[model samples]
Target: LLQERQLIYDFMYKHKKTYSVGKICKYLKVSRNSYYHWKSVKLAKKKDSRRTVLVNEIKRIFKNSRQTYGSPRIQAELEKLGYKISRAYVARLIKAENIRFKPKKRFVNTTYSKHDYKIEKNTLDRQFKVEQLGKVWVSDITYIRVNDKWIYLTTMIDLADRQVVGWSLSKDMTYENTVLKAWNTARKRRQIIH
Candidate 1:
């Protein structure tokens, strides 16, 4: 609008006898008040064109970092290259360009306790706190979805320290699988109780 007003003002000044402010405003499809206001304000010099180049470099850095960097990181990277741009400037540039990084996906739990195999009663119940490290051992079996297929995993945890003493993963979730995992866990821990 300022540039259009400047052009109109220049044209009117060149031919003031024939063209008036009202006539120029009508030709430009702007109101007389707007034209007057634009005429009153002094036109400032155009902004530097180097900002576009800097913004492009910032965007390149963001893309190269897999779009994981935010304004601060991007500013730091720019500073490393001797670009003395401000963080606020980088943030404004990103906002004006509507550029944003994608968020990471959430981790999903894959435990499935529903099965036909006779589930042993929770012998340890919730009594996880034990006096000694090897006093009580708790075991549970879970299934993992790998490549759209189910893989069973059995783990024996020491109730005292909540440490996974033993674990076994298998394609089948049968009684043998559960027993084998328990046996392996006991063998690894050198526990006599079977």
Candidate 2:
């Protein structure tokens, strides 16, 4: 409805010199009072001095934060600067100004290939699909933060069924706790007929 009003306003504005206001309003089926009201509101917004200042300040704060500050943080900063603004309003302004923030990536390096232990050969030759259960198994280890401490998780999956045959969680990444424990659990759960 607002868009239709805007289109009507634009059409009337463009053709105002050639056509009278009453005729245009009657043809468009809109009241002249509503058109005048919308024109007044738009002009008042354009004449607002605070909008320009706020946009500049918002851009400065966003740049100072290295483009990492989101709407909530930006709102807090604006409040600190004696401007009481809502987070939603700040977000809307940011979107209108085409401001974007970079998202922080959560990644942990769990694998360290440089070690004294012998590296095993790839026996599967990259062929992951298996014809039968227990024929091919894969394992992976990852870590999760728990209570400000890291807990390692190990999982063993059977390729045929694509199910987690065994899993283990430990505070340390030791072989006996992670890989060995998961392997022991897998052996107990499913028989390997090699």
Candidate 3:
């Protein structure tokens, strides 16, 4: 393929400090014009990678913020995470991605003020031991890349059984697929005699 020469040219460029460019081009069957054009493409790819990372990070943080964060807040969060970005730059990135964030409003607590919602105590206390098979089930979700697609894998394991009781996969990391489905399956498989 014609792109093969371009790849070889890139290989040479990566090692240009140690290898001779002329010999590499000759050996790889890439012409000088082809190498030069490929070089431009490589440079563009480098820039594109950085932009891609920035855009993805912006999207993640924006999502984690419940889509309520705009460019200013997103830029601030990125800065906190050690990324040097400006609000204008964030705005431009969002625009380029055709992303729209909700305008931030003042926080309002909608929970009943008089009712006491009891927080469950951590009875496990970092202990993994369980005497009953259906007692303790631990669940976690992870993202995996399959070619160009991202897959979220959720697995639940019974501590006493020491086996995966249930599992679910989805394109995006959402609780409906990961938590709900996995939980239902785990409950059925474990067969806790209520």
Candidate 4:
């Protein structure tokens, strides 16, 4: 029992990232039945530690502020009280405590693809090359599936060496947002052009 508990702790300490019960069992070289039994035993034996107390206090402050205090702010506040804690520790505590700050949930589309603004013709026209640097550029938007959520990423690439010049990420996929990213990337790279 002690060995199994130590194995579970070691596995979690080493992995850091989330793991499934099956993964835990596989990593610890134990059967699923044994892993679950040990997990329940360990959970039952668990007691509130000093870290838990500090985290609870942090959560109280976060909640009292209406969930506006993120990790950095919370860490700063704790430091003011003479608590020597790292931002990473605060972030992990927040996640473990399931304390979430209110995130900006409004999805605003700033892209005006249907507007009357002049559209620049595709200068590269699939000829993705340049004799000199920054002559041709290509950009695209892609979405990543993180858990059950979708994260949108827009990136501009220089055709000269297929290098990423700029990138932006958001929870919303807007045409204007993508175009602006590409334009900004080109503007920044203007000095690099021949």
Candidate 5:
């Protein structure tokens, strides 16, 4: 990502009359700190990487904080070490070094069970027995994680046989993708209607 910033800066430099660093940075979502960092890196080609020292300091502070400190807290620790640094720079360092902390699980309720819509009563009356194979089918929906994204799964199972009659997997849980498809497939397969 930083290398792309350099390439953009080089282009902006050649077209100085048409573009400024601020405009380029805004357009490319590149921070001014990164621009200055690239500049310092270029000017100090004769010397060793300056950020290597800062990176090491950041690592020490981060480790001392039990890896729970974000950029703001890390910057405070750096200040104690006589290094005046920006939190954004600290964030860049942490991102570049792949420093991370495990986040606690957060529960997000996705159900709308208490809404004002008309809800059906328990017609089955908690009874699981069904005389016919295709007469009574129960369905449920759930979401699965796939590469940081959620995909929904809906399954319809015959209560009498306790076997899955039909299933549908989709990226969303809308009616078209969720219970509708599964119900349609099960109905067609069983050739039965309620």
Candidate 6:
């Protein structure tokens, strides 16, 4: 149907100056009003095509950013690419495309609070202010991801001067490998005066 309409419209366009529009529509067995309406809708579709192009560009930028950019950053990138798009419009487009940004992982919790093991009492009782050099020591274990594997890091710090007394890195989170290794290093570095 569209192809036939297009052919009739093209024929009318090519001979518009030579022939009348009513005579052409009558001979083509189509209404003049339908041709006029299709012409107007075709003009409107040109604007819609521009929007489609912008949507494609936005999707490309979003993917290139690893889907980690929000509207403000996306708008900045678009501006750098010579696209003068507003942040709100970019946000709307992102929402429409269902693009979700993944937040950077800052801290990974390795502690299991619901464990069945015994919980140690807080001996220091939040009194971090230590006067003597070897009065108090604090230790913590953290995990780091490298090459799709998690490695454990244990660090022992002297609370008095806030200095790292010892540290250990292990492929596993075993107590002997992590805490004991760091503790041994600290004992070797300085005497256990406390």
Top model number, lDDT: 2
Q: Report the C-alpha lDDT of model 6 over 27-142, residue by residue, as the tens digit.
A: 88888898788778877898689778878888888788777778898899889989888999988888887888987667756567998899899899999998887778799988
Better of 5 and 6 by TM-score: 6
Q: Cα RMSD (Å) per model?
A: 12.7, 12.6, 14.4, 18.9, 17.6, 8.5
C-alpha RMSD (angstroms) for model 5: 17.6
lDDT of 1 by residue, 40-65 (tens): 55332122346777788889998987
lDDT by candidate, in order shown:
0.76, 0.89, 0.84, 0.75, 0.83, 0.85
Which pairs of residues collide in candidate 2? Answer: none
Q: Which residue runs of candidate 5 sit more than 4 Å off their true CA positions? A: 1-98, 102-104
Q: How much does candidate 3 score in TM-score?
A: 0.43
Instruction: Return the lDDT, model 5, position 138.
Output: 94
Instruction: Give candidate 3 regions above 4 Å deviation.
Output: 1-7, 18-29, 106-194
TM-score of 4: 0.34
Quick one: RMSD of model 1? 12.7
Per-model TM values vs. the true structure: 0.37, 0.46, 0.43, 0.34, 0.49, 0.49
For model 2 the local lDDT of residue 91 reads 92
Candidate 5 local lDDT, residue 77: 86
Model 3 — which ten-residue stretch has the worst lDDT?
A: 104-113
* TM-score of model 1 vs. true structure: 0.37
Model 5 poorest ten-residue lDDT run: 41-50
In terms of TM-score, which candidate is strongest?
Answer: 6
Which residue ranges in model 2 land beyond 4 Å of their true spot? Answer: 1-110, 114-117
